[model samples]
Target chain A: MTATTTVLISDRPIDPDRLAADFRKQTAGSGAIAAFVGQTRAEAGAVKALALEHYAGFTEDAIAAIVDEAVSRWPLHAVSIAHRIGRMAPGDPIVFVAAAADHRRAAFEAVDFLMDYLKSEAPFWKQEVSDAGSRWIEPTDRDRQDIRRWRSAPHSGEQ
Target chain B: MTTRILFFGQLRETAGRAETAVDLPPSVATRSALIDWLAKDDPALHAALNQDSVRLCIDKKVVLAEATFSAPNEIAFLPPFSGG
Candidate 1:
């Protein structure tokens, strides 16, 4: 059963180890725990930093909706998602998604589902800053495709 | 009816401001109507909203293009999300 759910959006860098440990404590008896840490790409000089912006009231609500949907669909014991807002330097932690469940597959898939939606569904905007200048980053075609799969019924072997 | 409209990210940059409380004229009631009304005065907002990349959230949830929303409170126009 899904026990604790954490959705956080902040300007500070995320501590993946702490987040995982907290979730592990919350889901003590859980069989499997899955964690993912998404960091800013270090593309040498190509991208210097990433600036993130989010709507104040709506960002939290949107993430809550995503978490609720995931909990409903899976038997997750606990889940935590943390994303950074404002500026983050290259290789800084950008996002963290973790799930603990009685089984490995459920924990793994729930994190994936939450992340795909977090990327395409949540209300966040990013700009890449480099020597050339700064420009707003848009979701790529793959991101759109990734989120669409969640709309249809969950089938086996779906990417 | 009054709607507190919000612009985030690139939408804010394009609109040249953060948010506005617009009193919807009887002629303009829905989100689409509001966009059309602003487009007349804000060419950049008009251009930005015209792109399919933009999205609308009434209150806090995303609304489909065809959804009808009564004027109550908040409405946010968003650029493509690139969170994580």
Candidate 2:
């Protein structure tokens, strides 16, 4: 079956459970499904809000490219990604990724691979608003390291 | 011809605006030349754009600084991405 991919960038709130359910239905015959949801942290009251900004057309295209890479690397049946733009309060969902494949390992690894790339390389700017002030966040060294691991790993097609 | 230049993330903050349009001169043809030209009046913007971490996009597609094009509709200066 041809892989079904859904990518969305929204200014409003995202419903992770709803997206997961919808994705589940889309990949019904797949043997496994892996999903991840990321949320803004309150940071123990230091953070008041988190703001995400993206280039209208370019950002979506960049993310879709990453999704395509993931599909090419794994034997995925479907993938869905949704990210929130604009201001979000603490506890709000920031992003969601789900992958379905014929086996558990493929589904699990695809979701992990997608998130690592999204955190470090996706075309979105993130800022943490706090009582002190707002500051733009950059990818940490660990984030870069996480993504680098996949660079050396052999892809399914390459093997 | 007029080219639209964009700044994102901290670059946008440094530029004090998200985008601007500039009419290019013949000398300001390459991406590096364009940055120098744009920064002629704004030192801080020049420094921000000069950072190695900053990437250039021409007409919505990321390209190397050495890449050259004529009368491209858009050019964006992007800082390192921090999403998810």
Candidate 3:
């Protein structure tokens, strides 16, 4: 099967619907599709905007490797990820992940893994532009905890 | 031998510059040594580099402080990521 594996980083907005349609077209035989969109929140009016910075050539490579690892451990028919850079307002979409597989379980698991990997491991930094003045932010402790779920079982189940 | 060191986010703010091309002295060979050498004059940068939260990337891939490469390579230092 000719499946598409896309990992994209853009300074422009990402279209989740368009990406979903493209993945569906590429993984024609897949019966299940799972998608996740990460949006910026207002943080109780603390944040006016969020500026994201990436290590250029490295950000894509790091994300691609994470995608490769996911495909290697899952029976995925297609996988697509998009991360937006630059300034984004609250309630704006910041990231998207989509995966397709023959079964719902595989698609769900792959998308879950993809999100954790992107949040913790990808080489992108974020700064909150606020009335308190801008400050760079780090992954929350919860993010680190979420990522740990995949460590002990990197390849526990596969088809 | 020279290498281009890049800084991002908070680290960039601390360094007050985006990139610095440094000519490596013979005494400064490894990543660890390079930091110590660069930190000689700048206390803020020294503190920042010595911070456990500092992360490094060589030629765009995350690597350990022990990782080594030839001159003219690109190296980046960044703080903890907050990407979603």
**lDDT values of the candidates?**
0.84, 0.92, 0.84
Give candidate 2's error at residue B56 in angstroms.
0.5
Error of 2 at A48 (Å): 0.6
Candidate 1 residue-wise lDDT at A57: 72
Worst 10 residues of 2 chain B by lDDT: B23-32
Model 1 agreement with the true structure over B1-84: per-residue lDDT tens digits: 677888888888888888888876766656678689877887777888867667877877788877777765888888888779
lDDT of 3 by residue, B1-84 (tens): 678889988988989998999887766666777788887889899889777788777777667877765663777887887778
Candidate 2 to truth, TM: 0.96
Candidate 3 residue runs with Cα over 4 Å from true position: A1-3, A155-159, B68-72
The CAPRI-style docking tier of model 1 reads medium
DockQ of 3: 0.83
lDDT of 1 by residue, A58-79 (tens): 7898899889888888888888
Better of 1 and 2 by DockQ: 2
lDDT by residue (A1-159, candidate 3, tens digit) is: 445689889999888778778877887888999999999989999899999988877788888888888888888888999999999999889998999988888899989998988887888899899998998888888999999989977775563
User: What ranges in model 1 sit over 4 Å off?
Assistant: A152-159
Model 2 Cα lDDT, one tens digit per residue, A1-159: 578999999999999999999999888999999999999999888999999999999999999899999988898999999999999999999999999998989898999999999999899999999988999999999999999889988573334
Fraction of native Cα-Cα interface contacts (under 8 Å, chains A and B) also present in model 3: 0.88
**Over 4 Å off, model 2:** A156-159
